[model samples]
Target: MDWNRTKSIFIVVFLILNIFLYSLYVNRYNEAQSVEVAGEKTIDARLKEDNITYGVLPNSVESATYISGKVHTFTAADFTDPNHQANITDPKEARVILLSPVKLRNVNDDASFTEFVQANIKEGGSYGLWKVNRDERIAIFFQKTNNRMLYYNKSGLLKIQWNADNEVTMYEQTMLDNIEEVEQQESALPPIQVIQALYAKGLLKPDSRIEHMQLGYSTLVYLTQTQVLLPTWEVRVKLSDGEIEEYFVDAVEGKIIEIQEEKQEVEEEDWGV
Candidate 1:
């Protein structure tokens, strides 16, 4: 029997299998990385198309810096904490408030935002859109977390600003006469219900995946925005005559902010996904 030769063959085969497995792992890793980069590029393209001027999305402010002019750069680093608010230190003048003082990020879902809005604040239907009264800017950000809603904002700073305002200070204090009154409460609207309403109204596409959404409004001025990543713009419907509209619409106000067609990428390959 050729036992020594058999053992040598087995070792060679084992080494080859290990090499094959390592190659597979490397290939898979590269594929996942590519997908993430593509997703980020898609997001950046959308932002540019919408005319939203933002420096690179900063993971941390450590890499962030204020360049000359009105431009700022946000580097890729995680934020110190959700508590970190956008600095308004360079008050040679009041900042143009390009993005607003409120920083919205890491939103898990829409309901968390609506609920937070419904609580701490009061929502009275006004001119068809849901209105909440507050003097300072309130920012809301959205991100998918475990398939649930997540919200990020400078709530603490907002509260401070509201308290400083003499006009709404009294009103807010009256509303918070008791500690329990001011405590955080979940939204009365369920996550599914809120999503369903947007869907039924055709404001949100059935297949749209909301990555980052923001809401900014101050009683002194009228500015409201909601941004979401959608698969198509064919979902928006006109409330005037129940006609199907697509893409951008002021779902909250029943108005159109702007409607821009999705940009298609040109590919050289005739048959490609």
Candidate 2:
């Protein structure tokens, strides 16, 4: 055998294989770019035709992981405070009703209200004020995990009902326990892509304005004792009729999530004040 000749032939074959692989990679990259460009143009045209406008879209891509937690069961031992009376409505759901009133120095002051919660409520520091309804005289707080809100999760909510005197007469609470990340970090869909998803689904109407877009977590699966949550994008839109609507999109799978309306109004009689 001709040693030099054999070595040269092997080298030539390796070079050919490398060239073939490189060409394939370039072709795939170009095709991906073309598809992305086409998608952008299509979305832009559709949005213009529908007269849809949006505020500044988030540009940075983010990664998140799936989290799971079990709802904490409330027991009499959990509430040892002498000032408030705690009623455990549902032990499995960890629902508690507080009957005693705790006056707030200033509900309008964030720091003051936070101090009140921390001093009066259990695991209160983990909750953040989500909304205040003056008509219902109620303030709703949601629990935060790793500094991010578990949006609209029933097992992690605190609802406080206050009288006209600015005294918190009653409240309902739920909490989650053993919270931990259940999956590896995965890249989430960008905000603009989520908008496009809503647009494609015909959820975005003509002359609508996207007011806000935020990343949060929504319940992906609910069980008897535990729940799984996924990264979600919450988009708030102002319709032409001046009505504000909120939509959620699954950031990982780009699917629209239909969230049922949770009643915020608490009857005066229910407060037992």
Candidate 3:
């Protein structure tokens, strides 16, 4: 009937659709590369620099310490490993130590990848399996005290990541041979308490959904021999805009701590203007 009018309307609708699709793509792309942390701009590049590179993060002497029931006394032998490029701080409350990867490699995923990790980690020492992340090629295992899990901030008794070749590319760990002598076990803060604390801190936003939650042990101090870890609650959240974020709560104190992967909670900000 009205051929010219119909043609014009069709063109206008097509242009609107194109614009809408472009906006969606741009939003997702920006969200992937960058995020806001506690109202500050942050990037994956910055976090990765200080986070776990191969298996563990860089450890240094940190003056800051937290109060805990466990304590590790050290002198000078813990940092003497020159072969692994190990770095250790004088034993204190919450200090961490880091070691360079012994034989780092990047490989594709295959059948043997899981087997290598499982076997070597078992061979390294038997601990409770806390988490396994194939995406990042890392497996987390923790030390248990009195049937209660001890959670550290970013580390466990042992953390490992393998490549496609099934070679142990990165391995970082703390000593846990005699945890009882250095510390005592206490009831962990319940999961409900952690969730509430996260909500109070504006972590669980409106329209957000929980992706996963787990309990594990993370290291508080990297001592001469072992790391002292406590119970930790890990909560992964997917925001309304479809971005995944991880929140870590101290299972003992009901407070948030820095994870080795990421330590800051950034606000979702769009910088692609």
Candidate 4:
């Protein structure tokens, strides 16, 4: 065997592997820090100026709000008592407002989150959940509200992390609340009524791999349909023991909308290059 030739090939392969790993590392790192919107680059930066920390991000407002073509705003608020008469050793309070790169409406608490999630499910869009504390939780559905972003957690119970394409992720508590709503609603609908509805619509076709369907804001079910594979436009349906269930139906038009699939379909583009 040619020892030198074998050694050279191993070195080349090792270098290529390292380069591939490095590229992946760089791409994931970039996605974690920045979100791209409307052909603009936006990043979250924390700066201490004059002993105050401010979060720097691109100006999302329409009116050319940045003085130097960039915007620096307060991300968290100070809770120092303005009425204090003397300096004390108590821990200073902090009020943090989570921001989304996508413009979203602010919901005050968990109840509002539930309402918003229900509305979005009815309208056919994706929803996110927020957990302010261990027991405090909220769910937000996209496209149901006018604002594309949502901010919550003044007391630090919620944390918002934005990905490269304005995708928002929250803790498990929030996801559970959102999923639970759909399950509960479907349980209340009569099974015989559900099967009859499918039969009337000519949806119970043989040899079809029926997936789950989404109903108005609260229920998702599986059903037998003529179409073996579900298109993105169809409501999520599932069929089990001849019972049909629906999820994420458009309240107005009865159209199915898959918000998560839509977000994942965006093409990867060079950012900050």
- Who wins the TM-score comparison? 2
TM-score of 2: 0.81
RMSD of each: 21.2, 3.4, 21.2, 25.4
Candidate lDDT (C-alpha), each: 0.28, 0.80, 0.50, 0.29
- TM-score (all chains, Cα) for each model: 0.27, 0.81, 0.42, 0.19
Tens digit of lDDT per residue, candidate 1, span 10-112? 9999999999999999999999999967865664465345432322221211111111111112221212333323333322111111122232222333333
lDDT of 2 by residue, 1-273 (tens): 999999999999999999999999999999999999899889988898989998788764679889999998889887787666766666743333445667788877656566667778889999988777677777778888887788888888887777888887767778899999999999999887898999989899999999988787888898988999998888899999999898889989999987664322222225442
Clashes of each: 14, 0, 17, 29
Question: CA lDDT of 54 in candidate 4?
Answer: 17
Candidate order (lDDT): 2, 3, 4, 1
Candidate that would win on lDDT: 2
**Which candidate do you rate higher for TM-score, 2 or 3?**
2
Candidate 3, TM-score vs. the true structure? Answer: 0.42
Query: What lDDT does candidate 3 reach at residue 24?
Result: 99
**Candidate 1 lDDT (Cα, whole model)?**
0.28
